[model samples]
Structure formats: structure tokens, C-alpha cells
Target: MKIIRSKSFTGERAWAALDIANMNGITTRLHWTDQPYKWHTNDGEEVFVVLDGQVQMRYRDLGVEREVLLEVGDIFYASVGTEHVAHPVGAARILVVESEGSV
Candidate 1:
């Protein structure tokens, strides 16, 4: 169990991969500035948790977009092969939990 602070990734508006497990999966967080960022996976599942501010997730497959105004305890999930991008409305933090194998 590892803990990461939000202030650690202050310079970049990108995904900070925290923990990785080949047998299990990976856990990461996207700390955004006032810019947009994209995250995609080939074959895995991911769980997104909003830590602060607002973020909008744009999906490429369905050609749909979702604006998630996340507080401290908000969470979302994304499936495999889903091309998704996120833009911060303001300064925001998002936690991503990814796992491999059968769910």
C-alpha cells in the first residue's frame, strides 16, 4: 500500500503511473494543470476516481462525450480498447486503477 500526494506532480499535466503488477495490474493518477490529456489502453480495465475539480472524458468509439464534474469522492470506469481523453476544466486530480485478467 503506497500513498501519493497530489502536489507531487505539479509540473506536468499527465498520468503518473504509481504501481504496476504484471500478474495483477497497474494503478495510476492523472494530475492535470489547465490542459487536456489523453489516456488509452489496448487490453485492460481501468477505474477512474476524481479527487478534485472537474474533468470531461471524451470517448472515441461511440463518438460521445461526458462531462464529469467530480468532487473528492467521485469515481468512474472504462473498459478495454476504449480510446478516451480528458480535459481539465480547472486544476483537477484523477486516480486510475487498472487491472488485467478476468474480472
Candidate 2:
């Protein structure tokens, strides 16, 4: 068993991630970032949870670019083929759940 303190975690690089679990082919991770992530599409479904600070989530819906502010405790679900990016307001901790090896 591991007890992780998400707020205190930091990555040596942008969007540092700590592996949390992989159950039944699903993976979970805790990420620390202060920079914006590149736009990309997940090969499978994704669940993004903000644990600390805030984030500006950008996505394309029906070819229209859109954004939303994700605050602490906010959860964003990205279905397969959803193109999205995450821009943290500052230093932020996030929990992400997706299929193993998904981008």
C-alpha cells in the first residue's frame, strides 16, 4: 500500500506523473504541472480530476475550439477521439485515469 500526498508531488519536468494503479487494464496517475500540455486525442476514454489549484481545459467539439475552467474537485471526462489539452492556472495536481498505454 502506498500513501501519496498529491499536493506535495512534483515532477522533474513538465506534467510530471506518478503511477498510481493499473486495474483490469485501466491505469491511474497523479500528475503535477505548471505548463500547458499539447493538444492530442486519447485512444480511449479519459477521466481528468483536478486535485489542487486550477486548470483551463481546451478541447475541440464538432471542430469548434472550446475551453473550460477546471477548479479543485472538478472532473473532466474525455471520450475517445476527443481532442484536448490542459493549461494549468499555476502549479496544479491532477489525477488522471485512462486505459493502459493510451495517449
Candidate 3:
């Protein structure tokens, strides 16, 4: 079995991710970032979990922009067709589960 230590995880670049699982047409990943991700809609749905640090999560609903602060242990769910982006407060580690090959 492989084990990961989230606290010591770092990437060569922002938003770098490591695949944890790829099964049943779904993918689970561990991501490290210190930058904002571009807004985009998922192919299916997405479940985001903050493992370390904080994030400013922005989304659009009814053409209106909104944002929320996601702290450690917080979770964010994005339904299909939901436009959203994430900006880290600094360096952060996030666990993301989504449809395989989705962006």
C-alpha cells in the first residue's frame, strides 16, 4: 500500500496534482496549489475537500458571482454545469473527486 503525508506535500508548480484513484469512471486526486485556478464547469460533479490551509472559492449562479472561504476540513460541492474557481490563501492541499478526464 502507498501512503501520502499531506503536510509535507509540495509540487514543482502550482496546482500540481497526484492521482489517488481512477475507477468507476471517477478520479480522486491530491492537489497542491498557491495560485488561483481558472473558472470552469465540470463534466459531471465535483467534491472538493481542503486538507490544509485555506481557499477562496468563487462561483457563479444565475450569472451572479459569489465567493466563500474554505478552511481546513471544509468541503465544497460543485454540481454539473456549475462554474467555479478556487484561489488559495497561500499554499494549500486539496482532495478532489470528480469524473475521470474532467477538468
Candidate 4:
């Protein structure tokens, strides 16, 4: 059992994550970032949730690029093969859930 205060969290790098759990084969993590993540596709699905601040979520759909502003409490679900990247508006805290070893 564990209790975490996600509201007060920071990281050393652009996307520093604190592992919270691993159920079945999925991993749940809390991440802190102030920079954009590299554009890439996850082998499995990904669930991105904004816990604090805002983010500009960029992705390509059917060869067309798009972006969405994600604020606190917003969630973005990226299915398998979905090429996407996240650009935090500033310092933001996010919760991510995906396959344990997915890239």
C-alpha cells in the first residue's frame, strides 16, 4: 500500500517519471515535464492524463498533423500505432499508463 501526493512533484529531466504501479503487464507512472517529448509510436496503447498545468498534445492522424490543448483533468488516449508527442505548456504533472516495456 502506498500514498502519493502528486500535486507536489518534480523531476530532473524533461520527462521524469515516478513508477506507481504495474498491474498485469501495464505500468502506471506519474511524470513531470516542461519540455516536449519526442514524436513516436507506442507498440501498445497509452493513456495520458493531465494532473496539473497544461499540455499541447501533438499527433498525426492519417498523415495530417493536429494538436490539442490539454488542461488539468483532461485525458488523452493514444491507441496502438498512434504517433504522438506531448509538449507541456510549462511545468506539468501527468499520469501515464501503458505497457510495461512499450516504447
Candidate 5:
């Protein structure tokens, strides 16, 4: 069995991710980032979980922009074609489950 200690996990650069698992066409990854990501909609649904630190999740709803602060243990679910972006507060480690090759 593979064991990962999240508190000790660090990436070489921002948004670096460690592959955890892949089932069917879906993937689970552990991501480390200190920067914000670009706004884009996914090809499939996405499940985002905050493992450590804070993240500001921004999304567009009916052409209006909205944001929420996600702390540890917080989960954000995004449906397909939902335009969104993630901005880490300082540094953050997040768990993401989504379709493989989704952008």
C-alpha cells in the first residue's frame, strides 16, 4: 500500500500534482499550489477538496461572478461546463477528483 503524509508533501513548483489513482476515466490527485489558476470550464464534473491552508474558489453563475473561501476539509463540487478558478491563499494542498485530461 502506498502511504502519503500530506503535511510533508511539497511540490517543486506551484500547481504541481501527485497522481493518486485513476478509475475508469476519472483521476484523483493531490495538488500543491501557491498561485492562482486560469478560469476555464471542465469537460466533466470536478470535486475539489481543501486538505490544508485556504483557497478562494471563484465561479460564474448566470454571467455573474461569485467566490467563496474554502478552508481545511471544505469541498467544492463543480458541474460540467461550470466556469471557475482557484486561488490559493499563501500556500495550499488540495485533493481533486475529476475526469482524466479535463481542463
Candidate 6:
């Protein structure tokens, strides 16, 4: 087990890649920021845990759009091949756990 502190980050967005599991894989920590960005992959699913602040997750598919709000202690999952983006409503922190595979 390991502990990642928030102060280790150089910018507004801090990150730490942790190998907590051997079979399923590990996790990544994403510090909150105002930037809106999209993430997609053909590899595997991604699990997100909201540690602090608020975030809006948007999913788009075949002209259809869906949005969800995530607060602290909330968890969300996104399957592979799903085009999505997440933006911080204020300042937020999220823990992302993904299966080890090609992206």
C-alpha cells in the first residue's frame, strides 16, 4: 500500500499512479481542475472515484447525450469505447482505476 499526498503535485492538477491490485490492475489519481477534456479507449473499462469537489460527466453516443453529476465520495464507471468528458464544477479530485491493457 502507498499514500499519495496532494502537495506532491506541481500544478493545479496532480496525479499519482498506484498499483494496488495485481490481477485487476491499479489506479490513477487526477486532481481537480477547470479544464474540460475527453477520454476514450478501446482497451478496458475505467472506474472513477470522486474524492473531493464536484464534477460533471458527459457521455455522447450517436447524437445522444447524457450527463451526470458526481460529488465527493461518489463513484462512476465508464466502459471502453465510450466517448466521454469530465469537467470540474468547482475544484475536484478523482481516483481512476483501470484494467491494465493497451489504450
- How many clashes would you count in candidate 5? 0
Runs with alpha carbons beyond 4 Å of true place in candidate 5: none
Q: Write the per-residue lDDT of candidate 5 for residues 41-92, one digit (tens) a residue.
A: 9999999999999999999999999999999999999998899999999999
Instruction: After superposing candidate 4 on the true structure, give the runs of residues whose Cα lies further than 4 Å from its correct spot.
Output: none
Instruction: Show the colliding residue pairs in model 5.
Output: none
Write the residue-wise lDDT of candidate 3 on 1-103 in tens digits: 6798888888999999998888898999999999999999998999999999999999999999999999999999999999999999999999999999899
TM-score of 1: 0.63
**Which whole-number lDDT from 0 to 100 does residue 48 have in model 4?**
98
TM-score of each: 0.63, 0.97, 0.97, 0.98, 0.97, 0.69
The per-residue C-alpha lDDT of model 4 at residue 39 equals 94
TM-score of candidate 5 relative to the true fold: 0.97
In candidate 3, list every pair of residues with a backbone clash. Answer: none
**Alpha carbon deviation, residue 76, candidate 5 (Å):** 0.5
lDDT tens digits by residue: candidate 4, 39-90: 9999999999999999999999999999999999999999999999999998
lDDT, candidate 3, equals: 0.96
- Local error of candidate 6 at residue 59 (angstroms): 0.6
Q: Against the unseen true structure, what C-alpha lDDT does each candidate score?
A: 0.61, 0.96, 0.96, 0.96, 0.95, 0.65
Clashing residue pairs in candidate 1 are none
Q: Judge candidate 1 at residue 41 and give its lDDT.
A: 50
Candidate 6 structure, TM-score to reference = 0.69
Instruction: Give model 4's TM-score versus the native structure.
Output: 0.98
In each prediction, how many residue pairs overlap at the backbone (N, C-alpha, C within less than 3 A)? 0, 0, 0, 0, 0, 0
